[model samples]
Target: MNIAITPFFRTLGEVADVQIGPFGSLLHKADYIAGGIPVINPMHIAPDGIAADPEFSISDEKAASLKRYHLEAGEVIMGRRGEMGRCAVVLPEHAGMICGTGSMKIVPSPEKLIPEYLVHILRSPRARRELENAASGVTMLNLNATALKGLQISLPPLEEQRRIAGILDAADALRRRRREALALLDTLPGAIFAEMFGDPRDNPLGYPARKLSDLCSRITVGVVIKPASYYVDDGVPALRSVNVREGGFDLKDLKYFSQQTNDGPLKKSKMKKGDVVIVRTGQPGRAAVVDEEIAGANCIDMLIASPKEDELLPYFLEAFLNSDAGRQMALSNQTGQVQQHLNATALKGIDFITPPIEEQREFTRRLDEIRRAKENLTTHLGELETLFASLQSRAFAGDL
Candidate 1:
């Protein structure tokens, strides 16, 4: 590596202290209490910031016992395992939180490096590549404090580092605003549905009732295969439970299957436009209408509910499935304790009151307008992501 390429290059260990969270031996489920000191686990660290409330918090006495693991504001916490490089900076309000197992901490010396710059460097593509190389695991990836300390980082003068961090932060803020706008948009359809039909279960309007089996021609499960069979490019699109959302589909993490792998299962569960796809596991009850864009895409562990258009439209079915009543009905029939699941047979039994076809059509027509706006915002978010990636590339390579 060219040492003179930038102002200075140093191993992270040289400029900051890298520490792991408390070991599993120190924490136990029994010690957790309500409204206690928040614990920072892998789930707590997010792109936005440390979650205000984590899944589990410990008693004040227990927290004091684990005082060595207390977090400090301006320090960074990151997942030591799973999606290796995920991290966030702690704010003053979260300074007292205890860093729990499955994460590590990085405390940058203020005189040597800025905390914002440290988070940016860790999130950049260069750091992610290095993190992947350092991680070790057969199933879930793992990162240790030693590996993090050894990460080689390029450091410019404090002023320049702050400048780059500021630019990135501004660009990030724009993306965040666009995301917030999109998130608000995501709720619009559900709001509209609730306004028009009220709750699906209560049916206070006294609309005609119909079982899902009567409205849907078929409610079939998707193909099942090993993760290794999925590809990044040039194959049939394969969606999983991860793809289905309440009001929309997430195509970002889509997988692909080759003809060799697709010959049998793919032929069986082929989807069609207007099919209402419902997740059977990993967040059961979530559903979305399959548009032309992903109509023929093969899915895994999801229910393909092909609605009878004469009685129920794809848009209306999707809205109902995502409503409060529909979610309750779906959840009730769900089996499996750890990973709740919804099979086709159970789903077919769900009773829902159908609105007048003409009314449903009018509601769908109005919904189309909102969806178009959300699509534009989603596209804008994608552009922002691309722009941020490009900026990070140049900033670190000393091209900015």
Candidate 2:
């Protein structure tokens, strides 16, 4: 059953006070200091909430100069650049923090709008689409105070707004817990590695160390050619730095290459099962093994290591490279002053302990078990996300 109510509407400007953050010229690089007030930027507006970096904090003197930019409890902080729908409510602890150049602050009138409800509405898919349409810029979408203020908002009675917000909050809480559980599951593989083989740096078991190249048949870079020029609507998927996670592949935002490109220039970069793809630049040192599902996929600017089955298992080598000790070794070999990267030559020279093939196989079996559990949890999380989206849609449609 559905109940329909004629809700009065108002422009965001009428029901709230909206203001953009300080201009870039107002807050220079020198203004930033350690152990000071944190600035809430677009990048800091995470999916979970605002994750302020202390490194971007400013001193009290600097903050006082920008006093008008300080955040207050219950206010909404929204990203003004890059992606739309990036927002979070300022909590009690976040009060006194400064707004960043890439953000905007919104304080809704309590009599007309509930801050939580407004945040929920702004984060909804429809609102995001409206915002994207209202935003300017072809390459980087941006929202100005005028654009934000002109946006129309549905204003149901106060109690109805609370009802919708409460329902959405409960659903969102479930999703958050599901994500937290998945994160906990992600740590199991590393823990297993630590328990079986002590840190490679310490070599507590006194395992013999060997050059990474000695254990691999081939170590090389992925397609160095400009891969974007070879993109196609449908063909072999081309993995990039974004596709690789710390211990796994994200597989989102993947570009594709035409079959012609795959057979021609991309032939050398075509991956096979058991090969490892390591990030080269953005987030260096992260590596993940190529499973059968994506065996024939191509990659761009990645470090590919084809481990010899006799000397080192692909899973074992990937775990080593992603381990704390392995990351330190990789970092030591990092090149490039502006953007640190791990080249094939540097990766080949990395020193790591050589565990017995039988022990490596045992670890692989345990890791496979953990992966299966993760897959199940991941599927459940996907379902929860769908349910939340549906709830948001219904709630905003006056169908809840």
Candidate 3:
């Protein structure tokens, strides 16, 4: 319907009243006589909108007392803290759900604005920027009930709002498809590993098995005495524990350290091309092969492996280290009361199967081919994701 923009562009306070629940009331702790009522929190509202899953639950008894805050099928709910300005329209399927104190419900007067249209407006960049500016806090920013209600939005006709939302929705779907494709690609390596080697625990292949220490000449922790002040724009990059991700190293976000830092521990911490870097602390067993570019880089206290034979490919070892068997071994050996950590001494004892030299080369070659194909697919997906974001930016800015 072609409603005037002036009437539709009203603050949330003008359209509906802000309701508050009892102090220290937990949404999940509420009583529900019928069944479990879905409780919405900041975490429940994803960047895309309403998440497919709910992290918490609530009962019907406590929900009844906060009836004013109860959401209808089309009411908009905005998170007021943590992830500020995240908004979602309550779906018809979620009619009985209750929202937490960190969320504020916006009941639109239907004559002026449509629920889905208002949701898009609130989630747009312009509206989010304004919310960020008004949010107050030292550690964690929060948009109070008053600030949320008083936020302004430029409204277009209901039909125009619907059209804009439709375009953005289509773009968002494309982005999701790309993400799904990338996830599928990640499964290929694991599947191949299982088929060729069988379960590492059971060792169905029954090849000659040896501890990691037997196959490698050296396995030790990286440097730890280096100072942060030695880091420079163009100097030797120090691979801290955080620089490593599950599949590979992220050189793009690397921190540099001066080559002259002389921290006494540099002798044991130098990384070579054929070395396998395994995370010993947080996210145990996560590892990656050091590529040629980062061959001489100094590593932190994380475990580094230097294999004794050219017969064993570093990539193949990395694949195994990231496998289910490697993770289980690392987790078992980890020590600590509060935060567990894996040490080089424990890692050396983890068992792995080794085929003949020729067979290892053949396996590595085939694995590389599969990884290259996955990389190509990932590249295309990233392009599609970028395109979708650009489309969203233009559509919301009224350029579309």
Q: Evaluated with TM-score, which candidate comes out highest?
A: 3
Model 1 per-residue lDDT tens digits across residues 289-330: 888898777888788999999999999988877876677776
Enumerate residue pairs that collide in model 2.
none
In candidate 2, what are the lDDT values of residues 163-252, reduced to their tens digit? 889999898998899889889978887888999998988899999999999989888888877777898888999999988887678777
lDDT, candidates in the order shown: 0.83, 0.87, 0.71
Which stretches in model 1 have alpha-carbon errors above 4 Å? 1-6, 24-34, 52-68, 210-243, 247-270, 279-285, 296-310, 327-352
Between prediction 1 and prediction 2, the one with superior lDDT is: 2
For model 2 the TM-score comes to 0.82
**Candidate 2 segments exceeding 4 Å error:** 1-6, 21-70, 96-102, 210-214, 225-233, 253-269, 280-284, 330-352
> Candidate 1: global Cα-lDDT?
0.83
| Clashes per candidate, residues 3 or more apart or on different chains | 0, 0, 5
Cα lDDT tens digits for candidate 3, 62-134: 6676676667787888788876658888888767777767787788777666777667667766667788888
Per-model TM-score, in order, reads 0.78, 0.82, 0.84
lDDT of 2: 0.87
